[model samples]
Target: MAQSSRRSSISGPSQHNALVSQNQVVLYNASSKGLTVNYIHPACHTVEEPDASTCPYCHRPLDEYNHSAPQAPTSDHRAPNYFHLLAIHNESTSRPLTPPHLEDEARPPLSSETMAEGYFDAFFREESKLGMGANGSVFLCQHVLDGNLLGRFAVKKIAVGSSHKYLVRILKEVRLLETLRHPNIITYHHSWLEPCRFSTFGPSVPTLFILMQWAEGGSLDDFIAQRRGISHGDTYQNSASPESEEAHMTKAQRIAAFKARTGAGASGTSRPANLKAVHLLSTDEIVSLLWDITSGLAFLHNRSILHLDLKPGNVLLTWDPNVLIPRGMLSDFGAARDMLHQGSRTGVTGTLEYTSPEIIMPDPMTGALRQTDSKSDIWSLGIILHKLIFFHTPWRNGNDDFSLLEQEVIAYPGFIPDPSITSACSRRGLPTELLTLLQSLLDRAPGRRPSCEKILLAIEEHK
Candidate 1:
């Protein structure tokens, strides 16, 4: 539950959902009915955009429709005329990958045959909300027959009312997940389309279901919050709830006690059983966790996959199962891309705060803006490192959005970790090597950043 709260929310401050990945690209027309569109990149899955006609695969316009497009789909069961135009739009734009969503030609694409409603009704039960995205909701699922012994899974469901592109992106995500196999990445179990059997509203929307490996430990942010005894909402700040002072004080006292027990103020004290943050984790262990991420990234890059978004929330944490230890794994391929098909784009697609300087900047030759490459992902990884060690972001310009934009533009390789981290690390003579490595990783120029393999090696040497 703690992990569920700290999404790198793409939506506005007032909005949140369990399923949506980020804010949907809402398109409104006062003259005509408002049309809202949100899609996983049709081919690359790099970025989610507003209601633009750009083909996510080629990053161009969907100029024409295919002759044999599926009829407009209706949310109502087996209905007509409801989604005809959406079908045309999706079918026309959806581009198949080279191996067509497979690692190699030996494997075939997963069939689009959706699972029937009875399967879910009989097997799985909703335990709680996991997370939300622009177009869907994710739930913690429990197996009815197996109890908790078999472990749990997260199931994400997208409604049929979403734009045709939205559904197609999900289809592509399923295919992509099927192709990917890595220990540091979220494991995809099963995905299928199912009719909503429970909703009382107008024609039941066809829902896309993706069952994923449940990282019971939650996201990286959540793990940090839990280890630090920090509240999920209003983090790295005064997170006291408006409801009661006693509970807040109790939490504060617990944190203080935890810090005291862990001896975070001392130099290289032994790790406490409950402590899991900067104080407890060894540089070796931390790098090992980082190795998990880098290995996962290497796997993606090897397959020509680019995980455009690499924030704390996107990197999930699961229990070791053998023990309570937290192990890192990458999740949420909604913003992932297939580099084999689409080249970098000039448009910015990720969160502004974590975005690299080069992503929003223009190329010298093309003069086109927002072109990002693998190095962009490295920049994001640098920010996550800052947060992990410093307990805050390096770009602390101000609270409002404008300041954030300013920080993204001017923030550079020279910026160090927060002053708090500096003080602590200075006392312990720690984070010295790690921060120095991060400087290279977070370089403003993409070409200056290190590759995934080198990062892993660097972490290994530091250990």
Candidate 2:
């Protein structure tokens, strides 16, 4: 039997079957007005095929057409005007066909303007609160299209306030996100400005809503906490409501809690006695996670952008059914800065624990605080690597004490884990190359630390 290779299947015999059965080429122009049957248009035939006969309808002779040319069908036509050469095959031969509507998959992503306030509420249904931060909250949402569940997404709602500076900052982050396109980086979908609903900044203020790809496995911070059997408290709770736990607390209570969490009022750094790592990652798993992070950091550094905050909390994870461990992707660019256009401001930037020594302590030569650069990120990466291996940072004091942390960074030597931690690493079969890379990255002098490119090479070697 003969069939139109790229068109609808022929179920029963028709008047065109005579030509089709002979394995001859045929073109049918399907239009809104009517069907031009048994006509081979000049535009439809190619030089590779045998010469086609003249079109009986218009009396126009067939001309050689480059079928591979990048030309789309005219909009007035209901379907394709040209068809491929008919081929003869057995009637019993069966093959699955793709539906025509599936072509819509190639359409470009929806624009932010098209997804303004009402459009978002109509398509996305909020499932649960993923996490809450000081200025923003993320929610897990189910995206629906024509009554069909498409997939899950993460919607980040940040309070913009009435200040122009805050609004510009949010817009800047959106622009930064739009320019980024890497597998290890979080994918940005859509963003829009809407009236603030949950903000304490009054109803007149606007909120910036950013739609991002959902990371099913959660953040690395939560992942590590879970593996170590550590409770993340309300801030990291997946089931916490949109209203934060501290929302109802009095101003004084909030301040007191913040002080305790930051180790501000505490005498010195101390780990909870009950803290223990129950499920530890193997050497291969550690290398794989670090490789993803290093690749992402390299991509950013190559473009002259710096991820000021490189803590585990900013690194999201997604699991693949085929892979054993979750894949890490860099997210949350709120603190990211473009060194090209922006001037460096020296203040405490990013989380206290993961911050670089140069950003914390004054320069020994000039007694002046230095601005953060790419090397600062390397120091933070070293901290993350140490955490992945030992399930805790190298610091003896707790993370929140900035004054003690400054002292710790100033007196920091090379990688020196506790005896118990050393034993744990030995049992995990940690590689010598990784330890070498870690030591180099943790160099107290910013000039001494390796670049992201060097770190990537070392990670590749470990792999």
Candidate 3:
């Protein structure tokens, strides 16, 4: 008697068994839309159609497919598209079925709780307006959570419909600030994207708020004016002879006499004696201030950054009187750029008076204005130094003649006062080494100018 062949039972409605050999059973699934079934082989397991009806090696029924046709010896070699099928097979149960949706309620939605605590409240609170600029308004905000005085921060709420270039420039400034960390450089504390709250705007536009350490003394330009007034008063009081009010009287008389005398002259030149009353800085103080500024610039340049706008307004003094020298902190990194190895070129950047000649003059060979690089920054620094010492910019009195201005700058290279003046008309005469350093820094050719490190070294050696 022949041995009875045992057939394997299907576990689900989608699952079915097909005969592989006399004793072997293969599981498979029938296509729900059609009578055709997909064959799943048990050994050398794969989903495919069998050829002919008998197994290729075993010479038995191709039980992989659930069909009345005779088993094929070999399986049809074709790739299967699993995506089309709605069911997946379970290896353990040998069944085809759908699984549960585990992701539906796995996580909770984020509400006001998940957000930064007190952020919304602090952002919405009424802030004391501090300053306004082209981009946005600054507000002195109170930290809601800690109640800590978040020292004078500028809440720069950007304007909507702003040009892409302006936005890019603003972002670059922020990025530059982010990488920069120095004592002299302004600190960029934090910045964040917030919804615009202006009454005129629709729904909400994207606005960026930058938190920075505010300069208490305002711009260097204002500071210089204040200093000038104080210095003038000090000069008047000190020069007043104690022995006789007559000395002061004579000084005033000589000035009036000189003005009367000069009334007949067409030329604007005044007598040296009349100009003697001008209270200029002592040589020592001027040199010291120059030294301080150069040191700040050196630090910035060593870090591969250029202060494109180095002027009186940008150099800030910390508010401490005992600190004899102006402990200057370089502000406004907005125009700064990396220039360790780049060549100098001129472009329409920086203040006109402080802008370098290389920027103003186009290179004949390239026919392009040199991009203001590190050397261009040095030129600006030289101008700033001249202003700090002389209390006047070199280009202040220049007529609208571009060629004449260029010639004057090229000829002088640096500040050039009359050689015959006996009095210390400017800040006390700077030391020889300091003066030499300034001259070198203010060279006509960018290549001729000394590196910021060299300048720092010279200052230290002189000290």
Best by lDDT: 2
Q: Rank the candidates by TM-score, best first.
A: 2, 1, 3
Spell out the clash pairs found in candidate 2: 269-397, 269-398
Q: 323-388 in candidate 2: lDDT tens per residue?
A: 898888899888898878867475677887788767877668987667667998999999899878
Error of 3 at 415 (Å): 3.2
Better of 1 and 3 by lDDT: 1
Candidate 2 deviation (Cα RMSD): 16.0
Instruction: Tell me the spans in candidate 1 whose CA falls farther than 4 Å from its real position.
Output: 1-115, 145-150, 197-203, 232-285, 321-324, 343-346, 364-366, 397-403, 416-423, 429-431
Where does model 3 exceed 4 Å of error? 1-150, 154-165, 196-205, 230-279, 282-288, 320-322, 340-346, 398-413, 421-433, 461-463
Q: Candidate 2: where is the Cα deviation over 4 Å? A: 1-115, 199-204, 231-277, 363-368, 417-424
lDDT of each: 0.57, 0.62, 0.51
Alpha-carbon error at 405 in model 2, in Å?
2.5
Model 3: weakest 10-residue lDDT segment is 77-86
Please give the ranking of all candidate structures by lDDT, highest first, separated by commas: 2, 1, 3
405: Cα error in model 1, Å: 3.1
TM-score of 1: 0.62
The CA root-mean-square deviation of candidate 3, after full C-alpha superposition on the true structure, stands at 27.6
